[model samples]
Every structure is written in structure tokens, then in C-alpha cells.
Target: MYQMLVDLTKPKTIRGHVDVVERSDAGTVTSKGKKKKRSRKKNGRTSSGVGSDEKLNQGVDESVDGCTIGKLFVSNRVIAMGSNGTIVFEGTYDGCRVAVKRLVKAVAFEVNLNLRISDNHPNIVRLYGTESDQNFWYLALERCTCSLNDLIQRPTVSEDQAKEVKVPKVMLWTDKGYPSTILVELMRDVVSGLVHLHGLGMFNQDLKPQNVLIFKEGPLRAKLSDLGISKRLVEDKSSLGDHATGKFSIPIPIQIVYCFNPIAQYLISLAVTGCGSSGWQAPLLNELQMRAVDMFSLGCVLFYCMTGGGHPLGDRLECDNNIVKQSKVDLFVVEHIPEAVDLLSCLFNTVAELRPKASEVLNHPLFWDSDTRLWFLHDVSDRLKLEERKANSDILKALESVSSLAFGTKWNRKMGRAFLKHIGKYRQYNYDSVHDLVRVVRNQLNHYSELPLEIQKILGPGNEGFDGYFRSRYPKLLMEVYKVMHQFCREEERLNKYFKGSVV
Candidate 1:
């Protein structure tokens, strides 16, 4: 899939080095610098009269040599069409390829917002420059291979293609869904972008798979795009206050009603309503105009990615209804990935204040690799052992929670008689004691290589060995420990000093 994107975006020389040219009216110019007049219809309107605001040759000119808008030479090939009558074209800015978004009914506010937020951030799409003419506004942005929506909806690779490609060690792409590793990485990127936005006192009101653009460069990178409805947290106080008090208007453009089909118009209306896309929006968005709304939408987006397009609340038709009713989320698809379940649980919390910040979401263990997760668990185990006697209420609660959810009663039964000979009464292990369970796991991890060959086979194979074994069998163990540790650290400031530099 990534290889296909690479092929699609590989630069093609439309025409040899062409100089930038200025034009007073909407018309195409040849590579030799001769202006070609656009054809007009019998009614005096342009031939391609898609909308009243759309100019035939302003941006989407069907010229063999392509047309220049400011410094950008926009190709006639339409990359995408927005319901709001905006057109995105494949274009060249300076020497680099870019996505040229031509907005007929130009919104000056959106242009300024993009310019303000798109600079010096890897995860936010880069804006090269902006241009305008009598009829349209053109924005030259970083060209990504495809949107995350396109990637998510793409068909799985054939057996032949799969056999030809060497999948990465971290990635696990099955016929059922996308690689868990890829989903985590892409989601981390989205969260990173959101952190940047929230840090700058802005919130992306509309965050969905379509708003996340994918760059298939070295590693597949995800960048947040489409900040058309985004708002600055500090500047929009009055509007946000109105939203909180349930006294806000959607601000739908009057032009959109005439241009799009009924279905497209309905979708567009929902999108630009300032409440966010139906399924991805938080339930209390109308009552709470805060950054946490973005987190709820992010959780929905993450759920979609992890489940291969399944929405947590329900299908698209039912999502908004379910959200309004505060219905239970359908989490069956991600049940195996406990970390994801835990993270999503927090993000999906109806209480806006309880939702984690973007930075906290980025630091989740769901994004961590096997080795890092093991190291964290090992560190937590050591801390628990050292602080057992002086453990706080939070620590005790965490310990009790983990013990109740132990992997099994006979945890050491698989280790064989010889392995347990060093320790007394190892036959009937205590599943009720967190200390015993932690000690057993720690010992197995600590002496994995020294364990007998049969015992090692029982644990599982691979470079990760016991880490992978435990992760597959008891995925929630790591999450439970992390929760306890996090709670403990938050309560005990002095104890947090020990984990100042710890990997979360």
C-alpha cells in the first residue's frame, strides 16, 4: 500500500523549468508565454460553470501546459473536491510539489488560521504561501500521498504482494486489519499535532481520518490538515461561551446549498456545524466548548484506525444518535489490545475534565514497543517491592486491583519442578497476592535465558521472549501496574522524584 503511494506521488516533469507569471484575469498561458483565452458558454458564463463563484480557468484549467496561479503551477488534475466548493489540485510551488487548495468563496479567517498554525511543525501540514485573484483564493500546502481516510479504506494486500514485501518487525498486518504498530504511530503523530495546537491555545473542532494526511516518505508520517473550522481557545471566548450556553449558529455558507447533491450537502452541513463530524464528536460538545472535545474526537478516530473503520459508538448512521443517548461503545474489536482499550476508555470519558490532555495521550504505553513496556513494568515492580511497607492508599488499591486480576492460580506450574526447586512452596502459587504475582513475573523475566529449554518454549519464541509471551496472555497486567504507578506518583510528590525521567 505504501509502495503504491510512493509510485503515485513520484514527481513527473509536466513541463521543463517554467518561470512564474502574473495574470489579471482567469486564463491559461502556454509554456512559451502566450495567453490562451478560456471558452465561454452562450449565456456569457464560463464553459465549466459548476458554481457561481467557480471561474473556469482560475485554478482548474484543462491546459496541456498547466496554469500558473501566483508562483504555483496548478495541474488540472483534481486531487479532491470539498462540499464547500473548494478544489484541491496537484501543483508545483517553487521546485517542490504541493497540494493547491483553491477556495472560490474564500474565507479570510481560515487562510490566516492556516498561516498562523502550519509553520515549523512536522505533524501539522506546511503552508508554503497563499495567492488570490478576482474570483478565487489559492493556498499551496505540503503535498501528502493520501488522506488517512483513503489509507484506512484501502483493500488489504494480496498473498503474492505480501510474500514479495518484507514487513517490519514491529508491524503486524493481518487480513483482519491494519498493523497495530502503524495505527499507534500514526495516532501518536495526530496526538503530537494536537498537543502543538492546544499548546498554542487552539482547538481543531473537526478532527477525523479525512483531516489526517499521510506522507509516505521514509516512514509513513501522519500530519493534521483541514483546520478550516478550528478556533483559537483564547480569542473565541464569547463564541465558546455561547456554545456552552447552547446559543450558537453553524455558519453554513449560502453557496454550498446550490452546488452539492442532497447527500453531500447533508454531510457538509454536519461537518461545518462547528460541533465536529457526527460520529467523532463528544457527547457534551454543545455544552462544553473546551480542548477536551478534540480528545473525544481523537478517541473516535483512533478507534476507527484500530478497528479498520469501525466506529466505537456504532456505524456512521447510528453514531450521532448513540452519542446523544450516551450509549455504551462497542469495543469488541480492540479487546485484545488492552492498552488501547484503557487509553480509549479515558479519552471516551463523558466528563470533559476527566479526558487526558494531548501530551498525556501521546505518552500512553499503547505507542511503546515491547522492550520499553517490559522495562517500565520491571521498574514498577522494583518500586513496588521497595515501597511495600510504606505504600500509600493509592499503591495499596493498585496492588489489590492487580492481584484480583492475576493471570491464573497455578502461575508457576509451567516452570517445572527443577526451576522451582530453589524456592520453597512454589507448587500452589497465591493469585490473591500482588507481591507473589509480581515476584514470579520478575523472576521469569530476570532469568528467562537461564530457564530450561522446555520452559522457554512454553513462554514462547522470538527476540522478545517472555515480554511477548506475557503481553499476549495477560495484556492488562502492564496497564494495571501503570495505572497504580501513575496514581501513586500523583499522590506522593517525593516518590515522583524517583521517576522524574522515567519513560511513560
Candidate 2:
């Protein structure tokens, strides 16, 4: 694509600067000028509401005209505006949207997005090109509507029904968003976006739910943007060591009822978020495991959107995934609760691979199981109604039965110890001795769910599956193992209470 970094501070044109002119086979360029325009309009400034057509009309004829940077002209509309300090216009370039950003900053560290994009992924925005002059830096980027955090804060969908009449209710960000289709679509898109980034050998150190957006839901397209803090995964000298990096917050509402007496506050802190607006950031995220961190955020997002409620684990107190595992998401988002449940099931897996990858979600099977969706839509509200009146003591009766049946295996093993042993034995293969084995599992686990038929027979099996003899008979055992570790968290809580009282 054609791109240029024209100096906006020019008081004179290219015709006046013979010595500073940069001539190429394509065209002539010059950096010789007073470098400050009399009016902001001349420098590519305009009100936020101003359309691209109006903004383009005020400048030099030699500036970006139509789709062409220097010669081409075509139809592409500017879909978004950048920060207030930058005069930017974005449009479809060769069928893909591209942002043409140019502006002056007093003392901002210059960024070159393209150099790092090859190693970046779909969830992380790509930077294609940049141009610079004495007074300004020009950047051409991929464009999307806005941040995912921006979308969450705007408005959510709620239902209202009155005696034979049903109507759509548009609600501002208060814990939930539109029903099933939107949430599933958002999840699907975000997963695909994440898969793309991981493909480039990069890790999204800041993979919060709000950083994801469903730009095109019907087709299930998501774009991961905002790379100011994104870093490249490579064998290079440049590494991100908190280079002014901050995080975005999910606009889902807060459940302040959680914060009551001091004892309650301690308990509430475990279940609720300390971040503003009960941000969907996972509390354990601060531990820096860097393994399955994004999955934690995705699970939290699913919890909020499906419930139209506040943060999960409201009455609990903990920072680890154990609290997340024990604290269930309470809303029964009727239409797609099953699908939501399934997504959350895979997302919160203690073992990252067993959890669904963002790519696998492109066409989730839950979409095919029409019965589950219908069941949720019909029963969820009734259950909630019963809950509101405190009449739903039996609301989760069937679920409780299922859990009892599921947990019966507890007699066979301790949750965390079994998995720890499983990992120990699994590593015994391909090792000369126990001492040489790397604590890390070989990367093959990434392809666990998507193994080709040729490799499946050897790696995966049934009636307990090959994992029983290899990893573990029931893969879900890992969650149980983590649960065992989570049990110890109460000891920490007890210690915390004692410390809080004793501290002088």
C-alpha cells in the first residue's frame, strides 16, 4: 500500500526547498519549511465529529487524496479517529482497513509498529508503516471501531416482559451485555484473534477481556488492537520491562453488596475485584504465572456477560483459581447458558492445553446442540425469579446431584497430588534420567485437541483414554488437583485476619 509521512508544520511547499528535497524514482519530497502551520486546520486537525471528506478538504492538494497515497484514488471511508493529539484518517486499503495517522508530539517516545508485527498476533494490533519529518511522525495502521473496553462500557442488553408484551431493553454497562449470540460471537472472535497472535510466537502479556472486540459478529471476526504495550517475542535485545505499560478495565458493574462489615470485606475481596468497576481481570493474574493468564480473563468475561450481574465469587475470599473454581458464575443467561458454560469450562481449565484455544472456538459444537440453548433460554429466568424470592433452595438440585456423582472420585485420589504425580510420570518418557527432564512439558500439548488422525491413536485413546496410562485417565483430574491446593487458601485467609488485627 502507498504511504507517506508528510510534515504538517510546513509554512512552505516542496517547491521552495531545493537543498532539502528528497527525490526518488516515484516522486519528490522535502523537509525544508518553517514547520508550524498558522492554523490547526492546516495541520490536519478537526473536531471528533468531522468526517474524513471535510477534514481532507482543508489541506494541501499534494496531501493524502482519496485511496492513493500519491497516485491511486478509490472509495474508502474513514471509520475512526485516533487520540485527540493526532490528526488521523483510516480507510479500506486493498480491502483491509488501514489507518493513516500523522501528528506532532512534544516529547513522546516514537513507536515503529511494523517492525514488531511479524512476531505479533491477531489479538495484538499490527503496525504496517511509519514516516517521519523534522516536526512530526506519521503512522499507517490497521483500523477497528474502538477498544473492547470501550464497547463494554457503552451499554448492555437486558430483558423486560409485561403481561403478554415483550420488549428490548437497552441497558448501560451494568455487568451484562446482549444475550447468547453476542457473547458467544464475542468469545469465538476473541479466541480466533488470540490464536493468530500466538502463531507469531508472541505472548499477550496483557490479555485482558476488555482488550478483545467483536468488530464483525455475524461473520465472527474479531480484531485485537492497542499495541502501545505489546511486545515482540524474539531473540532480540528489545524486551518489554514495564515500558509505561498499564491495563484496561472491563466495564461490567460492581456488586457493592459484597462489601459490608470488616469480616465481609475480607471475604468479599476474595470473590470481588479490587480494580475499578470490578474489572474482569482475574485476581490470580498478579501471580505472573504467564501460563493460561488470558484464559482466566476470558472465563471472567463469560461469567459477567452470561449473568447480567456483578463479578463472580462475590461472597468468597481468595486470589487463586481455586476461588474461581469454587465460586460459580450465578447468572443463567437462558438462551446460551449451556454454550456459555461449555466455553467457561474449557477456558478455566487448570492445564492450559485442555482448555480451548481461541481458534477452536471459531465454530463451537455447542452451537449445533440446539436443545441446550433452548433449555437455558426457557429455564434460566424462572430459576432467577425463584432465586430473587429466596424460593430456589432446590434451584441447583440436579446440579448438586451431578456434582456429587462427579466428586465421588475423590475417594480414589487427592486432587493436586494425583496430577502432580501424573506430570511426573508423563515426563519419565524420552528422558535419560529424572534429573535431566525439563520442568516444562514438550510443546506437543498445544495440539492436544486438534491432533491429526495419524497421531491420535498413539497419543489419545478411550475408555479412560490413553492419558490414563500417559497423563491421567480422566483429564479433568487436573482441576481436582488444583482444588486440593486451593483448600489451603483458607489458612492464608486466617493468617491474614490475625495479621490485620495484630498489626500496630
Candidate 3:
């Protein structure tokens, strides 16, 4: 839907749309116009961008208590949170000790993707009710004190401190010692929660330390909180009209706003997007689009955890820029300086391709334990050896012949020779090693060639000046040898066909 809303910042009418056609306010709504700029992470750097839009409110409201939607009360409970005030309330619901929430009054929802959370996913914060009669609307929720973000802020913890302590997955790498079984299990629950949410086609668009909570008084479980901006993937919503109304008679066209069940409100300032901290956004979310946004956030969260809350990407990124700023496929696994550096390099890449996928990340060398690491190394070595054999064979044949040279120009000849020397520069005396390296180079080349011309230019082919400089540079001898081998194979096949010789 085309929404012409006044840009509260610049005071001009700007347009935006929902990715899906929506008929009501609760339907999935995304902007329809030009997209906002997204920041990036590269090198081992961080900035204030991570916590840029954090709200300044303490959780203290007696309007509604735990599990009771319309219940009212009054409380002076106030607690300190990361640079803000937090409200803590204790109450009984259904004869069980329950914690209730009191957060800042929410004017807009904060998340990148679109998904609705209606009492789904066990690890997610369950919404019990909302209060909307008077001064302000209050969201009543089951409370927990352990935010992953808060846990990571500690300066450092000794191995013993971590023995039974549950740490966020994002901070696991910072404390090298293996997390306790309970910790690992809890982290896996977090992943499982994500899997469940995503499986239902829902994306927790807003993910950060604060949004992820660990239950302090029960089960030692982690739960995702904050659904202010959660979206629900709906079918055709265009029929609901330009201002489709849903369960609470809310306007449908505005994209950034989030509500559980809301009443009508004239569009004021557009809803603000909250990309938890600069280091928190993911490489995939540079554009702040939906699925990719959540993916980008996940990457950043992973980086922060590995580095013990250290920021990976410095914060901002231009759309058009080289994706790879690190050596090897350090897209995942960020431990030690190199791992963190590599991951920091890729986690917030302006381009989504530069970031590793969830599957690749799960099995990355950085996450692998000693056993898995050894196995990965072994597999990589075997593949390299097979490649080396092919390289050596080509080199040997090239060293033998002179010139059929249908390819290079006089200028090309000089450049090609230099290319050959450059290629051979990693002087390995072992023929097997030479062949393996050649194979590796070919695989890398093929991978690059398959990418778009635009992407290739940014990544720079790693071929340096070698790619087009040589006409697929041949060891003059290898060219001749291949020709002969081709003829011999053909002749042998012909003979077999005619004489009924061996099929081989």
C-alpha cells in the first residue's frame, strides 16, 4: 500500500509501503518507498551505533499486573538497567509466583522484519494482556531478570565463576573454557526457540541482549522478550482498504509501528527502527530489510558473544563496497585475534553474500570443538591433495612443449610469463603440493566467476592482475600435451568401437 506520511524529521510528505499487501493494521506492513541506510561492521572496531535508539524508560507501572490483562495496581519499584531505569514487580497469578513487567511507554514497535507473536514459542516472551483505558497503555508480561546483554557487561569472570553460570551464546567465545552442560543446553534452547519462531514463518526482527531474557526464578531457561514490533505474515490484505483496521481498529498503512491489539491513532512520527547497538546488527541487514535484517542481527549477536561483548564491526557501511576485508573464509568462528578479526570482517558486511549463512555458521571452524576442528582440517587437506595432483600433471606437461600458441599477443606474452612466475611464487618443491595449490586456485576462481560482475568487481576476483592478463595461461608444453592426449583418447575409442576391443 502507498502511504504518504509526513516525515517528522524533515517535515515533508514521504511515501513507504508494506512488502505484503495488507488490509488491516495487524497485517505485515513494510515501507514502500526508498530504504533507509544500514551500517556495517569491518575490522575489530565498535561504536555507539549499537545502542543508538535504546529507550530511556524504567519498568514501573501498576496499571496492569502479571497474567491479568485489565488488573490495576500501584508500585514504586524501580531498578537500574543498562544506562536506564528498570521496574521489577512481584505478584501471584494462578497461585504461582510470577514476575510482572513495567517498561517505557511504547509509541512505536522496534524490529527489522515482520512477524506477529501471539502467545507462540516457549522461549519467547508470552503476552498475557494490555491496559489501554486512560493515561497510557501498558503491556502486561511474565518477567525475567537475566538479559543476555546484561550478563555480558561484566568485566571478566574466572573459570569457576562460569562453572554453573549461564552465559549468552554471543559471549561464549570470550570465555574460552567450554560452557557448562547446562549453559550449552540453555544456549541450544535459545537456538531451538529461534528455529521454532522461524519455522512458523515468524522473524524476531528485534534481537539483542536485553530482548533475550533468562528466567531467574525458574527453569534456568531463556526467553525472547519484546514484541512491540513483531509482524504477522498474512495473505492478501489490500482488500482492507488503504487504512485497514484489525482487531483493535488500528490503521494498517503505517509500516514501522507495532501493536498487540491497538486502538486507532492518527499517524504522528513514523515508528522508529531499533537495531540493537551498532555491533548488534548483522551483515545481512545493512538495508534493514526483513529476513536479511534478522540474519544480520544474528551474526552480530554471535560476534558479540564470541568476543565477550566486544564490538566487531565499527558501525557504518556504504552499500557499494568490497565485502571481504579479511583473509580466508573467516565468515564464521571468531576466536583469538584472527577469528574475531575474520568474523568481525564478515558479520556486518554491507553485502549479504559476504555474511555466512546459518548452516555455514553452525559448522564453522570458530564454533567447532577440538574433535570437529581436526575432522574439518582432515577433510580440507584431502580435498587439497586431490587438487594438487591435477595441478602437477598440467605443470609437467607445460614444461615439456614449445609453441602452438594460438592465444597470447606479444604484449600478452610478457604479461603471461610474469603471471606464470607469480603463480609459481609459492615455491613448493613437492609436485603434489604444487598440484594441490593449483586445484585450490581453480576452485576459488570458479567460485568468483560464478558471482555477478558487480559483486566480482567489489570482491576483486582475488585474481589480481592475473585473471585477464593471461589467456588462461598455458605452460606451452601442457597445451600440446593435452591436444595429444585428446587425440590419443579419441583414437583409442575409435579403435575399440571398430574392433570391439575393451570398453575401458
Candidate 4:
């Protein structure tokens, strides 16, 4: 994607800067010099519109040859049509896939360029350049496979109608949920983008699921696009008061309204009236309070992720009625992952001032291990290296299997509580305690065949078939347990070895 943007921005020739002319009201066509002739292509229509081909045309103030409004990019197909009558075409520029947005309003070009031209972040969509013809303004943007909203609804939706339809089944808890790691990474991307935007004193007033694009070509990269409703915060009275500076009046469609909470609806009304989505808008939206607005929107996003596309406030009709009668949002009760529910509580604090900043949210225990160390900071490389070292070692493999099977006893309803109580002593430990726990666990595994009756029930009545299956899989699980314990012990050793008092 970056390579495509570079290609779009590259200077094609050494010609002097050309004066950009609005062809419809054109008067003068200047040349670089008397020696080089300047002429417009007659009767030739470029992909955008019928116009004279000025090969060395200027984009903004800079001269970029081989990039004419009509000939620079070739349109393949119309990928999507925005609710505001805008159209997006899948186009190719210099062999790179690009999404060319045919904006209905000319202001869109300025809106996009203002927020994204100098800003470059993986989590934020990249804008290549802008152009205009007689009817529409064309923007060259990075092509994304689909929107986050679409990806979330894909499992239950049919491909034929998937592009244009909504599926409620996506919100069902019984469905196969997205991996926890992916959800965490997606949230990280949103926070990272918000960190950059807020640092520059700007806020995306309308941050919603549809505005978040998903790039599936490589990683499941979530980028915040569509900055038409974003605004810059300055030191002034206008910043403090809500005077509708950066409100998007695009009416929220019935099928796509995710945020129907009363507070969100009220704020949306204050900014813009007449049928529009307010799902991502801050509860008490003060344009001056930039970071808080973004944090509130992020909280809504996190809630959606955690609940598998369930709206934080409620369904559309419920939110509409709740707005008139209800004072508080009925938060979803997450049974499987209470940690995520706790984080969401902080994010959705009624007092916007009390909400945690994006950086603070990133550091929350929701992203950390049982020991409070962040999962992303773990030395995965070391783990990979350790696994490679013991790949061919039979003794290590056997030990790993034994440990895993021993832990498997917890899956049984009858023995699970006993297993929990037994492991409680080893859950938190000092260097000496860790060593002792490892020794105890290792010794306990030595008598694996004569396991307690409670655990043996889960492994199935002792039989040749059951024994064979358990023997085949237990070593791998045991190895995983050993590696985790060993890593924790080694980390403590390193801390004590290098910094004498650090171990405490």
C-alpha cells in the first residue's frame, strides 16, 4: 500500500511547475519555456472526464508529469456507493490498486487533504492525491478489502447480498467468536491512530464501525478512514462551545445505525438534526474536549468487539425509546470475559473527564498477563528458539506431555475446583517458590498413569484407545506448560542476576 502511495507522489519529469487550471473556466495555459511547446490533447477523454491532456500537470503546487486528471488512473469498477451520493471506484495507478472516491461535494477534497496529507500512520488511511473534474472531485486513496462492519457481519451473511445487507446473527453469543488476539490488536490500532490524531489537536467527531476500514491482504489492519467530520482543536471560544463546527449531516440509514443510546442521540441532535447516525459521537460533545470524544467513541468500538457486534446501548428501536425514558445505558453483562467488561466500564464513564486516555487504556490489565506483564512485550522469539532446541529431544517432549495432562484435570467439573485450589499456591511466586512449584509439579507428573479417580474420569475409563490418544497429545500440552513456567522463572533469575534489589 505504501509503495502505491509513493508511486502516486513521484515526480515523473524535470519540467517546471505547471499552473493548474480549472478547465471549465480556463483562460490561460502557461508553458515551461518557449522551446518546449504546450498543447492540449483534442477530442481525448481521460478516465475521469473529457479534457485536454496536459502531460506535465501540477497537483496542488508541485508539478507531476505522467499524472493528468483524466489519464493518471484507470477505473476498473465501482466498489461502493456512499450514503451521501459519493461513489468509490476500484482503480489502478501505475500498476497499484487504488480506490478513487468520486466525491459529491467539492469540500471533500479539502476535508480529506487537511487531516491526512502530512499524517502517516498504519492505523490511519493514506491519501495519495486529489483531483477535480466538471462534476466531481476525485481522491486517490488506499484500497481496503472491506470495512470492519462488513468483516464482523461476514460469518452469517451470504456473499451475494453481503455487500449491501446487515445480519443480526453476528451479535449472537452462540456463534464462533473472533479470536481474542485479533480483537486486542484491532483495539490497539484504533488507540494508536487516536494517539496520533489527538497529539495533533484534532478529533474524529464521527468515529464509527463503517468508518473503520479493514485491510485483509496482509495483516487484519484496521485503519480509520473517512475524515470528513474531523476537526482541529484550537485555543478559542468556538472550541469550548458546541456550535456545530465538524458535524457530519449524512443521515444514518436504518440498516446501519449501531449507536442508539440516548446520550449519543442527544449530542447528535445538538450538532446536526434530521436523521443521522450518532452511535460514535461523544455523549456531551464539546469540540474543545478532543481526546475525551475520541476515547468515548473508542469505548463504543471496544464494546462492539467484546460483545461480537452487539451495540453498547441496545438495538436501534430500544435505543430510540430508551433515549426518551432511560437515564443510563444498560451495559452488557459479559460472562466469559469479565476483564474486558471492566475496561469498557472505565471507557464508558458517564463523566467524560474521568475516561481513561488511549495510552492508559493500552496499559490496562485487559492486555496484560496474569503477572501483570503485557502479553505483546513477551519475548516470543525466545519461546520459538526454545521450542526449536527441544524439537528432537524425546525426554523434554515426554516431560511436557505429562505436565499438560496433569493440568487437564481442571476441565472436569468435579475435579476442577480441587485443581484450582492445588494450583493457587503456585499461581504467584518468588524465585524460590517458583522453583519449588516446578519441582512439585514435575514430581506429581512422574506418577501420571496412576492419576486420581476424578481426573481419570475425564481422560475416559482406562483403555487402550483412550491411553493412546492421551499419550499422543499430552506431551505437546505439557511442553507448553513447562515453557511458560520456565520463562517466568528465567525472567525472575535475570532480574535478580542483573539488578540485586529488583527481585523484591
Count of backbone clashes, every candidate in sequence:
0, 15, 30, 7
The parts of candidate 2 lying over 4 Å away from their true place are 1-111, 114-128, 133-136, 146-179, 208-210, 214-220, 234-280, 283-287, 308-310, 313-336, 349-356, 359-504
Per lDDT, the best of the predicted structures is 1
Which whole-number lDDT from 0 to 100 does residue 175 have in model 4? 28
Of candidate 3, the 10-residue stretch with the lowest lDDT total is 17-26
TM-score of each: 0.72, 0.39, 0.42, 0.56
What is the lDDT for 223 in model 3?
Answer: 70
Query: Least lDDT summed over 10 consecutive residues: which range in candidate 2?
Result: 17-26
Residue-pair clashes, model 1: 0
Q: Per-residue lDDT for 447 in model 4?
A: 40
Q: What is the per-residue lDDT of model 2 for residues 196-264, given as tens digits with 9 covering 90 to 100? A: 655554445445545454343224334665433334444422122233222222223433543233333
Mark the regions of model 4 whose C-alpha exceeds 4 Å error after superposition. Answer: 1-71, 74-76, 117-119, 159-179, 235-276, 285-288, 320-326, 369-504
Estimate candidate 2's alpha-carbon lDDT, on a 0 to 1 scale.
0.37
Give the poorly placed runs of model 3, Cα more than 4 Å off. Answer: 1-74, 79-88, 102-119, 128-140, 156-189, 216-220, 235-279, 282-288, 315-347, 353-504
* Candidate 4 lDDT: 0.49
For model 4, give the 10-residue run with minimal summed lDDT. Answer: 18-27
lDDT of each: 0.63, 0.37, 0.37, 0.49
Angstrom error of the Cα, residue 178, model 4: value is 7.7
Error of 2 at 473 (Å): 31
Candidate 1 lDDT, 456-491, residue by residue in tens: 786667435566666655656777677677766634
